[model samples]
Target: MPLGPPVPERAQRLLAQLERYGSREHGQLAVGRRLLAEHPDLPLDGFMISSSMCPEPGRPLHSLILRVGEHDTDGITAWARALATEPIIDGARHQLDTILDDIGIWASATISEADYDMDQAVFIPSGDDVSFTHRGLLVTEFGEDGDLLFSGHPPAREVLAATSAYYRDTCGQRLRAFDGRDLADSITRGWCRFVAYPTRTDWRIRSASQDTPGALPVTWMYAQEGDTQDLGDPVHCPACGRSSRGLDYDHVTGQRVHLCPSPVCRHQWPVDDAPDLEATEHRQDQRAALAAH
Candidate 1:
């Protein structure tokens, strides 16, 4: 049986094609390029590294992979290192603290080396493997995959169980596990990241933390309210086509916050360079359409 959720048709077809490359003369080269072309939802906007060392040298490997969309990667790196050195319970709390609001999909796995090899061989373009260790708790980057954005593959059921044990040793608990065979599963489940209120009951994917509420919805919180802080020009929201003369512009953060007047499209976001909101929204629509299939 296929592991985890069913791989999307397009991804499954591409994966089959990628598998063929494993036997080609180049031997798994260009898999990442091909995958990115076929699936743009990858690099997952943002994610956190859930690291676990190999429990059994020969069996499948497991790790926690949380989809923390668009959070600063450097921040996560610093936090992961710091948590690794802290006491076990503290480390666990630290992980939750960093990602509780941003996290979308909480998936752990125990995937066969062969399966991971298949995904990595195609996804990782090239790089020397780097291992991260803190206080003897070992965590490593997923692979030499070309694009680090979507680096690791989800673990199989068995790999997840083994990984839970490893995570328990390293961080004090095992996350709810899923059996994801390829990157397609990751993309499918990742749709929740964009949703306002995500529900895990309908799918195999589960929340990483006990908190049932979804991540903070995207919004433009007012920074300053006085006339000095107000933007002079009538700015319009590209997403909703609403126009307003007064908007909050924070000099300290170097950000201009705008909230759409449209009730149906109460879109809020910061404007730094007069972002092409229409274009961005179009692209997101395209991605959602693709995922629906």
Candidate 2:
């Protein structure tokens, strides 16, 4: 059967995702074609693998069984790569896009979500006790219509909880550092703030972080701004009175509070995670500015 229009587009997106992160070996297009034949409607990319599960552990190249993206991107490839390395920046999106051009693809990034909203990047646990390959990031893309499209598995209780944790840690606590020369050093010696992905054993440390150290530590600093919520207030945004009923705090800071598509305000608040006097004032000024408009 001929591949449908969406099928090619979906493949493109998966490839782009993989390229952006520089994780895992590319998958065989033939395998992907066959897999697509099995589930023509499936929306997935990347593969999954682990170092411990590899015949050799900590050898770098031979440490992982890199499952799917050996030739193409799919869930499996996403899993393998995410589990393989530690992130260096706190709020930096993975540099996966760099590979897109090499793979005959282009990347387009959207603000997946407002800073204060719920967003996630998850690591699915591997079935194998020694597997280091099960991992992936789940991004929450909000629509102008006030709905959410969470990439990954179907929405459920566990998923929600896990997403919350991920949002808190990845975007909140942030991966502050990477160190040492290889995978083990990054994990044991604080080369990364996130260890939940690449389970230790499955990690194949081909080289040390020193061999190819990442950029600077990820930094996440928030202000006490906006309708600064009191320690006890649970019902409203203290800054502009944007309640939690149908709104969330915007985390993207072009240096101050910014109103997103959240209905309460068409305010020009700058997108950011800082919540302090300046952020609050910015929100207030944005609100006042919007009212004048």
Candidate 3:
């Protein structure tokens, strides 16, 4: 068989590491550090060894076996050099775009609820729009008129547009019209508050809170700001009128309900039932301000 392109320097180093450490066992972090130090230009993130995984774990270099199309270590090493030298950032971006593309294709073709549920396999009606929670990463929304509101995050807006354009320009499929700022205020604010990033394993963007490393806070923060602001505040329970800090926000549904800090009261009601005076007053002030303007 004819020889292929020379193994890339980065892959060559990984091959060397695999030889020294063996492919089955975890290599020293120092090995990865040395590899990284050697190639300062390579992106610190997004390098890939295959479609579903990357070379970031123990014996990550051996992961090249997925790409090299061979089981033998020698063959894998020989082929790793020929792997594309594209920056891992590009790979990450490409994967993101691909996810957006999948979402766009599904949303564009989906006319009825059945159609939407067919491919995405997940849909939930939230407020005025319907959220297509496909794979729980790319949540595409549609308006009442069945228009594509938005998909993915702000950072990937361009990629989303390009995918929509591709459907329009190439496939002649007129994707539902989308607005640049169609994301719900809650989603927008939550996205702004949290950070999301993709991994080589998949295009899922892991979300972490702005203040700490965790999921985004419940949507109640966007529901009626003032009340949710003091997540921990003593308040009179609507059911028992007892003052307690038992109010807790459900992370999944984003609903705030009093847990009744006072064991005697044991009152539980949605935040709607026990509107905070401060929030009500704030809303009144806002209304007055708008009226004045």
Using TM-score as the measure, the top candidate is: 3
Best-first order by TM-score: 3, 2, 1
Instruction: Write the candidate numbers in order of decreasing lDDT.
Output: 3, 1, 2
Per-residue lDDT tens digits of candidate 2, residues 159-271? Answer: 33443344344334211111111212211111212122222322212212422333111111111111222223224444566543222334343144333334665454433
- Candidate 3, 1-293: lDDT as tens digits: 11134555665555555445432243332333343455444332212222223433432222221222212223322222323222123211221111111111000010232222222322222332323332333333222322332333444444345434534444454332111123233233332121111212222222345564333332211111112123234567777776754445433344456566676777666767554555456556656798999
Error of 1 at 199 (Å): 47
List the global CA lDDT of all models: 0.33, 0.31, 0.34
**Which candidate wins on lDDT?**
3
Higher-lDDT candidate of 1 and 3: 3
**CA RMSD of all predictions:** 24.8, 22.0, 19.2
Model 1, range 226-270, lDDT digits (tens) per residue? 122123345788786778543443323424556566778766567
Looking at model 3, residue 171 earns an lDDT score of 42
Off by over 4 Å in 2: 1-125, 128-165, 168-202, 205-240, 243-254, 268-293
- Listed in order, each prediction's TM-score against the native is 0.15, 0.18, 0.20
lDDT score for candidate 1 against the true structure: 0.33
